[model samples]
Target: MPKSKITETLLNSTVSKYRNLLKFCYFLMVFVVISCGNDTKSKVSADTNENATTETETEAPATTSSKTILFYGDSITAGYGLDDTNDAFPGIIQFKIDSLDLNYEVVNSGLSGETSAGGKSRIDWILNQDIDIFVLELGANDGLRGLPITETKANLQAIIDAVKAKSPSTKIVLAGMQLPPNMGQAYTTQFKAVFSDLASENKIAFIPFILKDVGGVKELNQSDGIHPTVEGHRIVANTVWEVLGPVLNSEL
Candidate 1:
């Protein structure tokens, strides 16, 4: 072979070897970049899943338990003509219980136009459930209807006796009421006395008048002049709460 031709072949072979080496290096760099990219994606996916799990846990809510306090009465307790029952005094009391995170559930057993006699008839059935605190708000209807004061008093006493019989440990809160002067001064006086006398006799807690600030206030009452307005119920709730709060807190 010619010497020049042999040298040229060697040069070409060397250049080809260099080219192959360059190609291998380029492929290795690409493989490394692809591997790194895959690793990055896996890490990002794991981080996203972890964050989602944490968010789910953080967004969960809380729960409530069962025990009962009952408000038993006539239209006032029933929340007559109110837009929402919750806007009534009983409902307002319930909101307080919830806000305070107290364990007792407030039950409104108010019936529109219910008299003391009617309450006496139904109280036994009401006592069927265990009542922790009982608020008696009857007699207003009896007074309004001009029912016999003696009969009303007797019925109320019977209801109290029944409560004691059913749940001796149950705390009672009596709500007093008054009649307009037109009902006659003597009857009005006697009607008002019934509550004090009973409260003292039974040794139970008493609210002098559930409708103290609420009653006789034009804005506080509904159009009927009998049921209280939402604002009125708020005031009534405050009154009941004054007596009932201490009882509940002590009991709890």
Candidate 2:
């Protein structure tokens, strides 16, 4: 063989081998890039699915199906001086409902310094929702303000009538309140009797003396001797629950 021909053959063979090596390197690089892209997409998809599942698990349960119990009243019913609203009677009532797995939602519509007249005006707006049990605890402010008994009674009757008119099937629970002897026997007696009269006349459920043993007790009441302490509210919860529990069971 000629030397030139042999050298040319060797050179060509070397060039072809180097070109093949470069092509193989390019193929390897493309494979790595494609694999990394697919891996990144898989990780993102898995993360998205995991996040969705976590959100669903932590979401709050819906309350649309629950029956609502509306607690309508003044500061005492509002849990005036309590640390948290949950520490109040209405909240305690809710805790009981949750514990018993009752299908009831307690709405604390108590306003501080609210009078029966105030409640009368707000009754339409408050009764706007679906109320299963309407717990009326008003007129305490009216009595405290030395408001006329007849006016207070009329206001309370109007509120009750409004609740009845809005939700006719709603069970009415009237919470009777009393004033101190400072308010005088005649007026206080009439104030106390007003609730009884309304309950009797309307044939509704009644909770006489909603405050019961909690009123005037130094420890049970706040320093103002008006609002109840946490412990006091606990007793009040029991007082209300006594009548409310039965109404709930029978109504259901």
Candidate 3:
């Protein structure tokens, strides 16, 4: 073969090989661009879905329809001296309610050393929430403090009237209290009569004594001899349950 013919043939073959390489590079670039675009779209879709789920969860409302039982009182109801406040009568009552699967929540609004007057002052604030049952145990501090029977009675009545004014349908349970003999028979007797009289006048549920079985019992009371011990709270819970159980059942 001639040298010119061989050179022409080599040139044509080289040109054809270069054209095939260019086509392969073009196809590879197209595939890379398509793949990158799909990956970006997939990431955006995932981010949008994630944001929608977060917004849905954040905007969801918490729906709970549990009735509240408010125990408004002093140290006895506050469970003073107990390591865990849940060991208190009101907390124990909550446990009982939970065990029975009742839709009632007990709020222990018992403050240490809260008297009738103090309770009267704050009762309005406490009543701000919807109360299914309101347990009144305020007078013990009044009696312990040797407050005037008339003033104590008046303060208690005011509290009762406030409760009635707040919600007429709210069940009020007045827990009766007794003073020690040291407070004098005349004063103690009058003080004792105050609760019963209020209960009768108001036509509300009466607890003859909040600490029926637990009060004055050396073993049941704590070292202070004022607040009840864990065992004492158990008995007190039973006492409260006797009246509260029926009231709650009536609601049901």
Local distance difference test, each candidate: 0.92, 0.93, 0.92
Single out the weakest 10-residue window by summed lDDT for candidate 1: 60-69
Clashes of each: 0, 0, 0
- The TM-score, computed over Cα atoms with residue i paired to residue i, of candidate 3 is 0.77
Model 2 lDDT, residue 203, Cα: 97
TM-score of each: 0.74, 0.75, 0.77
Model 1 misplacement above 4 A: 1-65
**lDDT string, candidate 1, 210-230, tens digits:** 899878888999888878999
- Worst 10-residue stretch by lDDT in candidate 2? 57-66
In model 2, the runs with Cα more than 4 Å from the true position are 1-64
Write model 3 residue lDDT over 91-123, tens digit each, in one string: 999999999999999999999989899998998
